[model samples]
Target: MPRFHLVSDPDDPVVAPFRAIKERDLVGREGLFIAEGETVLRAFTRDAPQRVVSLLIDPKRREKLADVFAGLPEFTPIYLAEQGVLDAIAGFHLHRGILAVGRKPPAVAARDLLASLPARAMVLVLCGIANHDNMGGIYRNAAAFGADAIVLDADCCDPLYRKAIRVSVGAVLSVPTARLSRDESIADLLDATGFEGLALSPSADEILATLKPAARTAVLLGTEGPGLSPDVMARARRIGIPMANSFDSLNVATTSGIVLHHLRFLGG
Candidate 1:
């Protein structure tokens, strides 16, 4: 069992990283991100244990999380506090009584991540996806469908945001991710990486169900309101999900789930 340090005072510097969690969530300190709830923490423990820096728990829930604590590194500090103290420190009522701080690994180049994939691979490419919730949901879907990796353009929101990590149930930790350079175009990168780019758009020449999957496929998705940019759509083979009664669109996350699920079982 890791040693539990009692943190009674909300102002304790040891727990400062967690102070005003909601307000400072987007501001990661020294590449560290906050992981909330037991489910996300468990995923982190199983998938990225080395990234865990420390943990904070309500004293009443300590015994309940013994297995979790036992899995951490010996040097990891586990801070215990009463519920009220914990709530005060976080600036909200943390019903789960569990929170962890984790570090992000060094950024991997998009080309390098793509180059490392096997011949048979499915990749999800996001362009201008600014909503963190949608980003997290897409990552969860990618993991579920066994996507090789996710490549995000510079415009996408940070997947490491606390709510996104919580919403994804920690899929962000498990799936390999890379960001595109400012000068890179999503279509050109896919082409150079030897992937057949399929851009999902409402107006497209081909229906998604009609196209055969390639040995290496990269599905391109865009922001909710604008969809893919004109340049991006022009560069790739445009495909659309068929809807009845002229219903043209779905949420970007939901569309990704449906498209990824279809591609997962597509025999090359």
Candidate 2:
């Protein structure tokens, strides 16, 4: 069984792994992530079932979390502490009253994630999307809107970053994601997969409305300021959401949500 220990200080050895996750290069490695808050913790337990490694929660929250922990593997640790102790050891006030660390699960290739879908699918490809909040928001929307999968191009921030995981409310764990080590590899993968790589930009004459819904599409987005890289734009067919004001461009996450919703409900 996973070890359960009471911690009196923030520097407790048990908390070291949580602190290290902030600066670690965990992607594509065998390690895992730290997920905080009751919502995220419960979600992880629900989705993974047998994968949760350890859970540190305020003793008061245990009754609430019991259903989430039932029928899991015997080694899964459900560590409990006083509210004050839990908060102090976490290095912050407990917002959701719980935190858990899970081992990284095996990942699928970018091509495989898309190919597994049976019908025309709208997937998201992020190029240089460095903001964890933006990535999280995008992932939340992707899951809500039925996007097939998410692909991160080179130079993007880690999807498993603590802020990203919290912002995503642990939705990143449920959605399939693949990170390409190089930007060129993403373009090559998309081309080889027969996905219509459509770059979302304000400069394009073609809008989401102009496209047919039946087409298998991959929407490529970038950060708010620089937008999609020139190289990525070259590889993608230029398309816009057709805003009324000439000066306004939707935030990348907002644009992604709108586009995904349109595809999900309107098939456009």
Tell me, by TM-score, which candidate is best: 1
Instruction: Give candidate 1's error at residue 69 in angstroms.
Output: 1.6
- Give per-residue CA lDDT, model 2, range 121-220, as digits (tens): 7889998888889989998898888788898887888777777878887888788888777735667787777788888877788778756654778888
Superposed by TM-score, candidate 2 places the C-alpha of residue 267 at a distance from the truth, in angstroms, of: 1.8
RMSD of each: 1.4, 3.0
Model 2: number of clashes? 0
TM-scores for every predicted model: 0.95, 0.87
Pairs in clash, predicted candidate 1: none
lDDT of each: 0.88, 0.75
What's the lDDT for residue 56 in model 2? Answer: 78
- Stretches > 4 Å off in candidate 2: 1-16, 19-30
